[model samples]
Target: MNENRRWSTRENDRVLDEIAKRQQNLRKTIQLNRKEESDSVCLHDKLMSEI
Candidate 1:
């Protein structure tokens, strides 16, 4: 029974680690998207100024 409990705890820790990794990836993706959007806006303004 103790071994089973330890196995379950390890499994839970793995699941939590996976969740943390996914969340970190999600944050990075969001930040990248925001940067892309801001860059596009800057480009649009620059083009308009040239015209």
Candidate 2:
């Protein structure tokens, strides 16, 4: 009974850790994508200016 309780707590912690990692990764991905989009827009604007 005590062992089962311990295992349940451990499982919960593991699940929470996984969720945090995923959230961090998602935030990073969004930032990178935004940066990439801005870069492309800048390039497009430069091309238009040149033309």
Candidate 3:
């Protein structure tokens, strides 16, 4: 019974770690996308002003 419990605990820890890593990656992706969008907007504005 104790061994089973230990195995379950390890599995739970691994699942939690994977979830955390995915969340971090998602956050980084969102940040990068936002930066790209903002840059595009700035470039658009600059082009309009030049015209």
Candidate 4:
């Protein structure tokens, strides 16, 4: 029974770690997209100013 409990705890920890990793990746992707969008807007404004 103790061994089973230990296995269960390890499995839970592994699942939690996977979830954390996915969340981190999602945050990074969002930040990157936002940065790209801001850069594009700036470029557009700069071009418009020149014209």
- What TM-score would every model get versus the actual structure? 0.58, 0.56, 0.58, 0.57
TM-score quality measure for candidate 1: 0.58
Residue range 1-51, candidate 1, lDDT tens digits: 999999988987886676567656656666758776566557556754764
lDDT of each: 0.68, 0.68, 0.68, 0.68
Badly placed stretches (over 4 Å) of model 2 are 32-51
Colliding pairs, model 1: none
Candidate 4, residue 41: how far the Cα is off, in Å = 28
Distance from true position, residue 27, model 3, in Å? 0.4
RMSD (Cα, Å) of model 2: 16.8
lDDT of 4 at 30: 70
For candidate 3, lDDT tens digit of each residue in 1-51?
999999988987886676567656656667758776566557556754764
Query: Could you tell me the TM-score of candidate 4?
Result: 0.57
Clash count for each candidate, listed in order shown: 0, 0, 0, 0
| Candidate with the larger TM-score of 2 and 4 | 4
Candidate 4 residue-wise lDDT, 12-42, digit = tens: 7886676567556656667758776566557
